[model samples]
Target: MDSFPPALLAFNLLLYLFTYVAATDSLTAQDPYLKDGFSLVSSNGNFELGFFSPGLSRDRYLGIWFKNRRGPTSVWVANRNTPINDSSGVLVMNITTGNLTLYSHDSTAIVWSARLLRKIPNGVLQLLDTGNLVLRDRKDENPLNYSWQSFDYPTDTLLPGMKLGWDLRNNINRRLDAWKNPNDPSPGNLSWRMELHEYPESVMWKGSQEYFRHGPWNGVRVTSRPLGIAPILNFNFVSNEDEVYYQYSVPNKSHTVMVVMNQSNYLRIMYLWSATERQWRLYTSLPRDFCDNYALCGPYGYCDIRVTPSCKCLEGFKPRSPDSWTAGEFADGCERNKLINCGDEVGFAPLNQLKLPDTKRTWVNKSMDLEECKQKCLSNCSCMAYANTNISGSGSGCALWIGDLIDLKLIPDAGQDLYVKMLASELVKRGEVQKTDRLKPKMKISLAVIAPSLGLAILFIGLYIFKKRSTVKDDHEKIEAQDLELPLFDLSLINSATNNFSIDNKLGEGGFGPVYKLDIVFGKHRANGLGAEGQTNIFEALE
Candidate 1:
């Protein structure tokens, strides 16, 4: 082959270098990323932004994924809903609009575009190691702020450090929506978002209805359960004037973790990549059991998995519909057994190891103590329960719930205590019931020890009476058996009146045997029973 001239060869080498730079480097206003093998890789080489088809899909999408992973793991997709049928796609920064636009098949048709309020003359689109694809002004030195970012519009997976909440100032809600299916990148009905209420909480929705909730943040963690111990993962939640968001991070770089809202089973799952297993192992999942279903036990009721028929009414409450409740249908919930008198004396009944009720109608005071919380709840007729907002250390902050309490669950080890409001009379009755319950075991033990002793005493008296009867030989001492007439009393009736000859009713021990005083009145007659050497003699007399 003939060698090219020096001038022509130099020009050809420059063209190859330009092509190589465009494929791997960030996309600037001047450099457009083409669909034909061109891509952008993060500086740390952890993430890549490119145009590709997901799974066996022939449709192409602009997305970000792990750079050197075994299989394609797309974290964020730009044109997920709209895909290019052919490979003619280009991602470029429009100079006039100062926005990142994706064009598919034709230059006139726009597939998906990200807009910025203020136009930047020198805009640059870059992919970060944390899997965030951002468009920022080239002159800006701060990496924290971005004109537009993929983290603000997450798809199925919630990568580490990505905010999953609202930007109040801009009215932007950042939430995770699951894909339609394994092969499709379209948005699904299942979504996980931070709900904005008096007390905000992270909730998962199945379309318009609530499916599950990771209870409100309680200064430590979400009140529903502990995410995990420290050192492995650190979860942060912030709520203020401008923004409210929840984010989690793995402290150790060796550990790879991601949260995905799976559409197939409608589950929010956290997966940790296990190096030993060479696969993603399930770390945790929400809606863990049947009790995790939102409002499964309805209002004023709680679900305890340890008990049979998990749904149970709270103290002072009864099933709203007894027939329905007995049929295992808890949707009707529960109603107060005794209605509360708002002006009358009232107190709080503590329910322990419980996942706090829904906070739709709630009030919180970060500086108030638990006693203050109780007083506040008591003062408000609508307030049904109160609890310490933070259970760390001695516990501070107050959370009061108004209206009917819903979605209560028994969390056992990782649950908070809720003080439910009750009438003073009900409180006293509950106290007495508890006292009786505590004494039941002791009562059983006493009966076990005393019953045998009483039986032996009766047996010994019977033997003495038999010997006395055998020794009686005088004709006048032995009464004529034919003329003797005595009314026989049922043993059961005698036992009932003397309370089974309880030790409490025992008078004193006589020469014959132990005597029991039975002042039981039968009709117009009073009967007294004496254990005279096992020949229990009953004497009836009018009172």
Candidate 2:
């Protein structure tokens, strides 16, 4: 063989290093390091792994991207928040433990670590063509048998076969959160998560508040999503007792598609890669209208984006703050026109064909029917509303609300009916009037108790005035008594009314003076104040 020069030998070695990266897939303990210049390719040569700088940023990130691709496309990132300052970073899978770590220059500090739960002997870190970077045993290629995987953790992009939901058993929340900016891959304010409530729904949140909801996943599709099943796209939702998630897969691998929660506009943009166009084409973007915004119409307010002024209070209710509501800020929501008094005085005003309210303060009884749910709401004075949890098959299950109803909107041919608790008088206007005869007995008893109580209340006020005038001893405090509302009271009459302002009659004390009751609780009973213990149930704010 002819003697090769040192320069020619060096060139051949560099060419071999580059070629080796394009062919290799699995990285084991023996081959622990993949340096900055080297890359890891998927078994099918579909995806590539390397340290790359995003956009104009000087900081480098350890990421996996489409093979032969350049900028504007990286699927997943490991050290997104903590970027490597230079290109001297290296990926290392420890020999003793099957742990993957990205290291800075000179292998001094770790930029990121996988922190695998179980150590697998002779384990391999393989980048699958499906874009899942998993740590599994070489003998077991089964995805379920894997000890650790990158699919559990996600970035802005949700790829095919990637789950967007929860793993309750492991407390792993598989959700998509947006990047801080175009260049920065750090988590932003917007997030996409499955709201596993009485009815499991996919909602996008801006911070803690709901920004948008895909509507709940009905049997057909997300109730509000305009997208339909097509030849290229396949949608799936799996919700058992343990885990609940929404996964999308492309049956034809040739068709490229992904859902990106756009950081700039907080829009969940579905994109399909067009080989013809040589770029990603926008399939759809959600929150297409002002009505799509979470709680766009506020509490008990129904929004109709088709209407010019969409925000309008529900029947039997009015805007809590009309001024703010009219100004296009309907967040204050609406309050009842007639406050419900529980029992027979209340009837349900059934609002149909609308998005249901937020379920944070909701109580669910899966076994209860719609009628049973209505009865349960009526029994509890705190319950403000109730709705069917499942509307697919005759609506089985109950969802009861204890507080304000919010984020409701009109979606024609979509959403379930919400039966709001309202006074019978309010319900009458909506033709939902209940039997008023059931309320007559309570009304009669209330009036009989109130008549004598009103006369005693007048007498008690007279005593307080006399006591104030007589007790004023200081020269500066000496004030004339004005004969205004109440009839004059003798000392005997005043003493009889207040029980001599005794400890038994002492209602409570405030900044003005101590308040005394005139047998108010025992109402028109014996002169002796009996059965009145602890603080009186009678709440009086005396002037």
Q: For model 1, how does the per-residue alpha-carbon lDDT over 1-543 read when each residue is reduced to its tens digit?
A: 999999999999988975676446477767755564577787777788788888788888888877656532678888889988888888778765568878876677899988564676777777777888777788884755678888888988898999999999878899999988878989999999998987889999999999998888777788778445334788889999999999899888988888888899999888777778766777888888889999999999999988879999998999999999999999889998789877978999999888888989999888999988988988899889999988889999998998999999988777888899998999999999989999999999998999999899999999998877777744534565523654566899778777899998898898999888775665655566552232344442521
Off by over 4 Å in 2: 1-10, 68-71, 195-200, 218-220, 226-232, 239-241, 424-428, 432-543
Candidate 1 collision pairs: none
lDDT of 2: 0.79
**What is the Cα-based lDDT of residue 70 in candidate 1?**
54
Give one digit per residue, the lDDT tens place, for model 2 in 315-365: 888989988977878888888886666565888888877777776677887
List all candidate RMSDs to the true structure: 13.0, 23.7
Task: Please list the C-alpha lDDT of all candidates, in the order they appear.
Answer: 0.83, 0.79
Residue 482 deviation, candidate 2, in Å? 86
Best by lDDT: 1
Q: Which window of ten consecutive residues has the lowest lDDT sum in model 1?
A: 531-540
The estimated TM-scores of all candidates read 0.77, 0.73
Candidate 1, which segments miss by more than 4 Å at Cα?
1-25, 34-36, 70-72, 95-97, 139-144, 226-231, 436-543
Poorest lDDT segment (10 consecutive residues) of candidate 2: 534-543
